[model samples]
Target: MTTLTVGSHRIDLSIPAVMTIVNVTPDSFYAGSRTASTETIAARVREAAAAGTSMLDVGGYSSRPGAEDVSPGEETRRLAAALEVIRREVPELPVSLDTFRAEVAERIIRDYGPCLINDITAGEADPSMFGTAARLGVPYIAMHMRGMPDNMQQLTDYRDITAEVCSYFEEKMQRLQEAGVQQVILDPGFGFAKTVEQNYELLARMHRLTGLGCPLLAGISRKSMIYKVLDTDPADALTGTTALHWECLRQGAAILRVHDTREAVQVVRLWRKFRENS
Candidate 1:
């Protein structure tokens, strides 16, 4: 069984786990996910915890394609507010800070002490990220993305998406290990740089990524791959999201990062039962 250690928290990966999204930015693709204030974030955290989420991922900077870039100071200020609420309301719940900036990662670890770092750029955006994560000794989530959010869509020219992603991980994992960063998690980055068809292809071959020797996290909750394929909006994409989530579990995803906590938890439970019975 694989496990992710963040600070003193050891997350068992023998069964699938749910990581709830708590966006502190107003411009996130999903409007419902954006919490405008600390009070709202605190309430959302409580709701997600009650809904059975094993972890909470808080992001101040929106990684949605074409998102306006915020200054690091602003991003840090936003994240600090959300972190304060998390520490005050649910100190025991394991938290993951979603940002690719090494400055933000370093500051958060210095102030908050060992929360997981979810870097969408996989250390390519900021050169110091791997070293920072290594020094902090926290679990690191490295997502596969070709470029920054502002223009990543233009950078998706891969011969074989799965093979390329696997190679990317193989290379990045070696560098991270060399940097003394342990407890790594791999995220395929559903819609970052891939087209809708490519996203589906990657999901179809997601099992291939398990060979990287890290827990796989599938963040396909109400993403464009679901809404666009279904000819619907994100608010109406829950059914499609749930359907694909089952496929993700079947393909060996250990963690599901989602906006709908209750449904994701239920999916994990049902997937575990199916695996046990099979």
Candidate 2:
């Protein structure tokens, strides 16, 4: 088992672990998962933590395509409220802040002390984010995407899907390392920059990314990568997410960023049991 340390928290990734999505905004793609109030957000965090979620990703901004953009102050307020409640309720739970803006990250991490930063832009939005990660000394989740939330879907122009993504990460890794950020995780950003066919193609060749030598975080939960192909909505995508989660685990993924923590935990446990007997 491999354990990833960010700050003082240790995420045991020797097996694929589940990261529960705790959206503190109203505009997240999943309507059932949004919790904005302090009471509701704290209750959900405790419940998910008890349900075996290794980390809770609390995002105030919705990165969904064409979603409305929130100001840095608004995002900070929402995250601050949620983090305060979580810290009061369970201070030991490892929490990750999902944002692409370095300014927001700097402010929130200073006020709330988050252990990890999961940026969807992979530090592309602002070049200063890598230096911010180094200064904070937190594990940075570098995701691959083509553009911002508003125009990303339009920028999906890729000739060689796998090679291009690997090349992007190679360049990003070099840039981040030069900036002195060593602890980084790679997320392929399944639906951010690909067609449904390209999503599966990347999953089929998922092992190629493990060659980067960083922990792999697969975030296909309720994403368009699964639901759009199934001709279903986000609420009905749990089973499809679990199926793909298992496939990712078998392919050597270190973490699974998901909305449904209980189902993901079950999948990882069952996969481990099956492997042991096989």
Candidate 3:
């Protein structure tokens, strides 16, 4: 089991935990997850907390493949609004800021105090990200992606997806630890830089990544790996997502970053029961 320290809150990871997604961007790959207004963000936070989510992940920038890039200023403003609502309405719940920009992360930490930083770039996009995370002393989530979102799909030329991803984490984890980051979580970036086949391949061998000795976060949620294979849309991929969530847990994932909190929470609960009995 792994533990994550976000501010004064210490998250015990003996059992799998759910990190619910609250996207403030309009162009997120999943249409159902886009929440722009403060009222909607507050409502979503309240709902996710009630549904038993262990953490709330708020993102202003859209990281979907080929997604339009938003400036740091805009991203900061959007995140500030969302965080303000979360601070006011659901201050008790731990929050994770989903951004790869160091400036945006620094601003959020200064204003919001200590929280988790879920950087998709793994500190590659912004050279200052690791230092900023270390300075703030927050849990950093390093996701494995080969390239920028606009061109990541074309860069999926890994000789061995799992091994390459594991190697990537091994290198990045060393840098993060050296920079004084105490807690680092691994996210395999399921749809960011991999082909549909590669995504499943990595998931099948996900347990191999556990040797890195960090908590694994599986963010398959309503991603294309589920919908594309099922010949369905993201809107209808909940069943498939739930199925894969079980596989991820069985493979040693400590966290599930998901758009649908209730279903994921149910998955974690049932998976825990199954693991206990077996």
- Please name the candidate that would achieve the greatest lDDT relative to the true structure: 3
Rate residue 207 of model 2 by lDDT. 92
lDDT string for model 2 (28-136, tens) is 9989889988889988988888888888888999988778889989998898888898889878788889988888889988987856899999988888899999998
Candidate ranking under lDDT, highest first, comes to 3, 1, 2
For model 1, the superposed segments whose C-alpha errors exceed 4 Å read none
Q: Which residue segments of model 3 deviate by more than 4 Å?
A: none
Q: What is the lDDT of residue 192 in candidate 3?
A: 86
Q: Estimate TM-scores for all models.
A: 0.98, 0.97, 0.98
What are the lDDT figures for the candidates, one per model?
0.91, 0.87, 0.92
The total number of steric clashes, by the backbone 3 Å criterion, in model 1 comes to 0
Q: Give the alpha carbon lDDT tens digit for every residue of 1-278 in model 1.
A: 38788787778888789999999998999998999797899899999988988899999999888788899999999889998899889887899999989999789778987799999999998999999999888899999998788899998898999999999999999999999998899999999899999999999999999987889999999999999988999989999999999999999999999999999899888888887899
TM-score of 2: 0.97
- Which pairs clash in the backbone of model 2? 1-14, 2-14
Q: Compared to the true structure, candidate 3 yields what TM-score?
A: 0.98
Worst 10 residues of 2 by lDDT: 1-10
